[model samples]
Target: MQSKIDPDMVDLNERHELLYTSSPIAALPIEILSLVFHEVQRTRRATGKPMIPHVEITLSHVCSHWRAVALSLPSMWCVFQHSYAPWYGPVRPTRERLAVYLERSGDHPFDLWIDFKTNEPAYQRLFFPLLEITLPHVHRFRVLHLLSNANHPLKEFVEQLASASAPLLETCAICPDYSHTSLTSLIANKADIFRSGVPSLKYLRMDETSMFGFLPPLDSVVHLRIETRRTVPSWIPNTAFDAILSLPNLETLSLSIELFELQAFPSRGSVPKEPIRANKLKHFRSAYVLINIYTLSHVVAPSLESITMNGVDLAGLDDRPSIPNHVAFPSLRIVAFIRAKGGSHGARHGPNLQKLMAGTQNVEELLFWGKTGIEENTEKTHCMLLGTDSAPSPWKKIKKATLNIPFSSPTEILLYHQFIAAKPNLEVLRVPPRCLELPTFLQGVPPHIDLRAIDESEPPLPLCWVPGPDWLDTEEDPFLFYCRVFE
Candidate 1:
């Protein structure tokens, strides 16, 4: 029997081929189209924006050839993002949509992000079916993020993670709505659920008090950030210190703790006697008020290169009942003090700075940030950096210095000139725009110094000094500085 080709079908195929050949983008190779899709998805993820469902559907709608190419690539349809809200009615339709993505993914590794906002009693009935579809594909999940309110059924979801194994999982973050404090403790108790599952996990971030009872293998984590709530001080027990000490390969660590007004300081008996040594640690940052600086003395990082203390109380370092004689960071190359408070003006600030800088004599860069406005206090700002005139400046070998403080007053301008004269090896001087116009101030300063005013329109430093993304907002206190090495 001879198969007869219908003239209608043959004509339709010829028209489709003509259209595909005429379109410039449709002519691109399948591999190039796949890379373009991956890059678009990657950029969206990096921006922390919501994901678009049925991404393949959007691309496939372009042309017949594009639809066939998109249907052939499973990874293009792997991302599953859905927001569950009680007001949106039943999630049965959403589950059907999720199944479509899973079927299209076909064994390719995928990323899953689910946001649960419903607190209604019927949420479990609507949400469980979606979880059932997702749990079976855990092995293929490379990134998983579950964000829910305090009252939502997170325990059930966590239980599923504990029971399942995900060898490909690399990044995981579970965050509870900020209003719910009880949920932090609840999640902490069940933290071990994913412990045995995610072997390749590297980055982890969570609320400060949430990881009390649960911790992953410390050695595998290279970067860790712990965020503290504004209402309470971050209280870490002795056992937590033990876990921190066990991290052999940890590199960067950030701790943000704020002490409550009513909270009492911890007794000396509760402080850990032994130091926590992180041999591989490179950068360490402590933000907000640290009740007892001595408590941080326990953390010894020989390889530490940068230290940032923002809004910290340096006076508390000496205010302790008894101050230790020596605290060392031998390899420190950069030290930044921003908006630090609570130190005695002439009494403790100088000695405290000297004690801190004594071990960091080799520091190449020093940054001092102060209030930046027309109504600036010269004495308070100057005292923060140079300390008392009688005391020796701690920065003997400092190659670069950034003074991000206002120089509106003559006294303030003169103080900077005096500072320049003190640092015989001083190379670069960066100041505010106001400082640059002071003709009398510029002519009197050292000629060899590389003096430059900070451009107001430029961006601020990239370090973790500011709390959030609105750091560049004009409402924020402006900071200005510059630096260079004089040969």
Candidate 2:
């Protein structure tokens, strides 16, 4: 081999050896490597990954140099996920694990998800000690998520949180018990958890609707979401309505309320007799939450860009003030109607849809998801989506149409097809795979437009009218596809 080696080959071998001797990441500065590690953890959290041993622990095991860097950076250990489930055999929250994170994190702020849920009843006794250890560091919490359900224990922890002050808490998500009979809200004594005031609080998400009473002064909140799954009467008090409209910095507001006691409530809330302009509010979402239009009418968001109304009931179509001049969205761009199941109640979601379309002239995207069934009430609903021959198209500005609705009847498909034909500016169409079964379906679609068959919940591939949807799904590794598409 030595005798056969050419001078050029020797030079090539030496270069290859030099390249293989050093790691690509080893050349990167410590700061850049830290950023990369942080990005990996962030992506995992964003994707709902609550893995074992923490991602920092895995990074520390890569090599001695990496271990040194990971241990040196307190931020690398600040996010502690002490979540436990029954599936992980023999893997539970241990004192040593908690101690390691607390000691390594040092004075750095914490992003904690304390989901110590276990099937065993005795686990309650084991978790309180852990919470007590964590309670002292409450002031350093930047983000906190506490998950507990109806059958699990919470009185002990809720009592502890009632007096705890989180000065640095900016985002908090509380998933309380889902059952109607159980304790629905975390605030039992109506005490604000953050006694020192959450001036830094910008985002709060609550699963139960009854948590409104214990909510602290939300003047500084930017994003507020209350997704109540209970079918009981969960009315938003006049005070709560006023609090929402008065938020000067509120950018997004999502509410999911039941329809049980909506009809009995008054049409308007007092005090805000005049329209309060929500200047900073850009997105408004309501799911089956029939707030008195007369009350919410006072909230005029001229800067609103997106609207998502699901199973909404705007009183009745014949009712007064369907589209009040005071409630107009000139800057609106996107509209989505979800779970529009048909019936008398299903039709009510349309009047607001009509009002929104009539009120705006710049709607650029429209999504109709989970739209099913047919009934007497759907007549107006069909008209609202299909448009009339006599009337001009108001959604001519719509560039993308996401059709997650099924066409069981030919008339329904025709209506949707007509809706598509009317929009000359429609450049992208996202339909379900079943739509391809019909040969004539989208046959008229111009080759210039990107037509994708994807699930309603998933986003369409961003290819320039070429690489099919299958290409996006070809790579077995999600990271490779993500990099190929996004990078």
Compute the lDDT of residue 115 as modeled in candidate 2: 62
Error of 2 at 138 (Å): 1.3
Residue 309 in model 1: shift from native, Å? Answer: 1.4
The list of candidate 1 runs beyond 4 A from truth reads 1-21, 39-57, 78-99, 113-132, 148-153, 177-191, 212-214, 229-234, 258-269, 288-292, 311-323, 340-350, 371-381, 384-390, 423-487
How many clashes in each structure? 0, 0
TM-score of each: 0.72, 0.75
lDDT by residue (1-487, candidate 2, tens digit) is 4354354665664654444336586788889988988888776665554555557888887666778788999988887665555443333446557667878899999877666445666566666666667777888888876665544545565567765677788877665544444333232223355655677888776656336334554667788776553456444435545556558888887665542222224464344556667788887766553553532455678888877765434434455344354346678798766654334445444455555566677888887665433455454565566465655467888898876655666765676677677888889887767776666666656787788775524543221112122111111211112112100
Candidate topping TM-score: 2
Candidate 1 lDDT by residue in tens digits, 1-487: 9676554776665666666676787767888988887777666655544444445666776667777778788887887666664433467877887788888899999877676656666666666668778888988888676656555646556666665677887656564433423221222223465556567766665444346333344456676666553354444444454455447767776655441121124553245556767788787665543432543355677888887665323332434332244665778887766554323321224344445666567877767666412123336546545534665566667666777665666776666766776677778766666667778678767778887766534333324423122211111112212121111
lDDT of all the models against the reference? 0.57, 0.60
Identify the leading candidate in terms of lDDT: 2
Q: Considering summed lDDT, which 10 consecutive residues are worst modelled in model 1?
A: 471-480
